[model samples]
Target: MTRIVLALAQELAAIVAVGFAQRDEEVHQADPATVAAADLSGVDVLVVRSEPRVLNAALVAACDRAGVRIVPYATDAAGHRLAASFGLALLTTLEAEHIVHHTVPPHREPVCGGVIVVWGPHGAPGRSTLAASLAAECARGNRPTALIDADSHAPALAMMLGLTDDGPGFASACRAAERRTLDAAELSRVAQPLRATDGACSVLTGINRPGRWPELSAERVTACLEIARGWVETIVIDVAASLEEDGEILSDMASPARNAATIAALRSADHIVAVASADAVGIARFIRAYGELRALVGDTPVHVVVNRVRTASLGLDAKGQIRRTLARFTNVEEILFLSHEPDIADGAALHSRTITDIAPKSAFAAGVRRLAADVLGQPDTAATAMPRRARRGRKNKPAIADVAGVPAQLG
Candidate 1:
């Protein structure tokens, strides 16, 4: 008897389960949410609906890697084409009928890996820097990391890493994902590769123009990230702050999802790194949005990061004060405090390099490394501070306020 996992649309699932039960197959039904994560292990086959609620492309590819064949059900000829587009064998209507009547020894699922979405409330809370730095730091552990700029409102990874935004980028990747052709090789081709002294990462630059946000439709963005799980160990995404589903809910007609990219990233993430710009205004903005973010992620692990931690804003024991404020309002259990380092932020932007690449031993870099360690479940052996020579001109450095809320903007 073959072990089969069924992940289909709810109503369709019941019909299929009854039809496919009498066959010599051990069948188990999985929730759509569970299948979205692609956690298929010790299963021989995975049956799914064509163009499933989740990105079926990722599920199909993941199953292929596990030596499992996907038996996609398509009521019509178009459904078969959609399955074929994802590189799965075409299970024609007739073949699907045969499988329904009898058992077929084909199909499997995958062990999806880390997909971390770094997000924050608007006001330049260091989302881009944290995403880039986290990817770079995770890469230092010798795992292939991909840093994606999914911030439709303000795409900055291309500029921060000094990579060109001219060529095929994340938009191109999304198009391919929508077409169900975004395999590992295609993703590698579209993404610009960034190599640092200690590690390297693949970069998927965001849309060049803000108006081009429509290219990142929820299905496309979700599919792109889903297919991406097969490409690397760590996939770090920088997303916009807005979580409002206003565009989706307020209209009777199907409206364009303005914040779809951000929403999709949050929903697809295995872990979330929520950054806040450690200031009165920044904290207030975060507190207001915390509830909405919580509602969207639904039990996904969230790690709060208080960026630019300093006495200028919150006074003595700034970390403690901020912690109390957040505890009073939100459900943030553990907080990671990053020191205010304007010099490092400026120097990196001046050189168009990542923080670790420019000042690997800086306190800011150390904090990012720690965040990466926590996300990757690794040890935080990052250097505490830069060498004396590397810290030259410290006395002549500008005020932290002058460059506050700058890293996410610059790097």
Candidate 2:
């Protein structure tokens, strides 16, 4: 009689038993956690149930190096993370769920969807706020939106939305992508649902730590975004600020992982929201970065958001100065101006309430609402009378989509 270890219990156990029974292998039942902990020096096939088991990366790596196949019947986020770490492929469960194993399947078609990337230049430019706000706004409008925090370094979306300690973030998602085990259900399991008090919006927070960047890559980023697009109407990606500044781990150009994640996100974006500080230096950075971003993502629609705008600094309207500078250097016709609202900083600092919720009547909120409308394809019904030629391929092409208070559009 051939001996086989069985870790999953109940219906899963019966199903595994029958499968081995057909193959004439003797089955030995054991706790799934025990299988993960048991020494497999002489074991042929080790099966473990997918549950609150701590299957570290080192153990999975050791199994691979020693030719021991670790079969994880993981239906949850932890199992998927383990399987991907070990380069294992998942097998289908009797209950119609997919778990991680150690093989590759046939090529399948990728899901069709759109990506909304909220990227920022160096410095705190509020990319997280934009990503969260847009996602929540879309959800509020009854459009399903999946918010992905792709900022591998210094992740802030989870904390911003009060989703820390929820579950695995981008790391788990990437691991699943590496193992070819990523699917809608697995993605949903790992993704913490951002409960909408006003409506239905789904948000998947990013990894909270900067040390776990290795687990997520550009390929995984692409796969996760792809999965999100299929599961929702829009994907709001909150990614790290570009590496224009030195000394940032995620922006370290030398790091292939960092480069891959950032480049992949830029390439995959259907529409991009380029965030910049509202100060003179920030505006200058955006002017320079816009050229580089354009080169990275050719012909993709980009919206420039000048965050934290304050006229008191320049003693005159700083927006005019920034606009003049942008118009002179780049053909970018539109720039959205968001004012400095102390309430926003207070909300984030004291309470975790989103700027949209706490300061809905604030100037910053109003600006973001206009920007959101533009993103959602809502016409500016509040705009004053204007010429209507509807000229094709002109800078004015974006005029129909541009918000009134927002700056000029990028041609």
C-alpha lDDT values of all predictions: 0.75, 0.62
Candidate 2 regions exceeding 4 Å error are 1-113, 243-255, 381-411
lDDT of model 1, residue 290: 92
Per-candidate TM vs. native?
A: 0.71, 0.63
**C-alpha-based local distance difference test score of model 2:** 0.62
- Candidate 1 residues 1-411, lDDT tens each? 667777766776676668664567677788754574666767777776664334365565677677665676666544543454454554444233455453443562221237899999989988898788788888884678899999989898888778898888999999998876777788999999888767789999999889999899998998887667757777999999889895667664466688999999998887898988888999999999999999999998898888888888889978778877998999675887777767788887888778877876566666676677777776555432445663463547432211222232223
Model 2 has a clash total of 7
Choose the strongest candidate by TM-score.
1
CA RMSD per model (angstroms): 10.5, 10.6
Which pairs of residues have clashing backbones in candidate 1?
45-107, 68-107, 68-108, 69-107
Q: How do the residues 70-177 of candidate 2 rate in per-residue lDDT, one tens digit apiece?
A: 566656554553344334554436321122124443443222225778887777777887677667666665666688878877678777777774478667877886
What TM-score does candidate 1 get on C-alpha atoms?
0.71
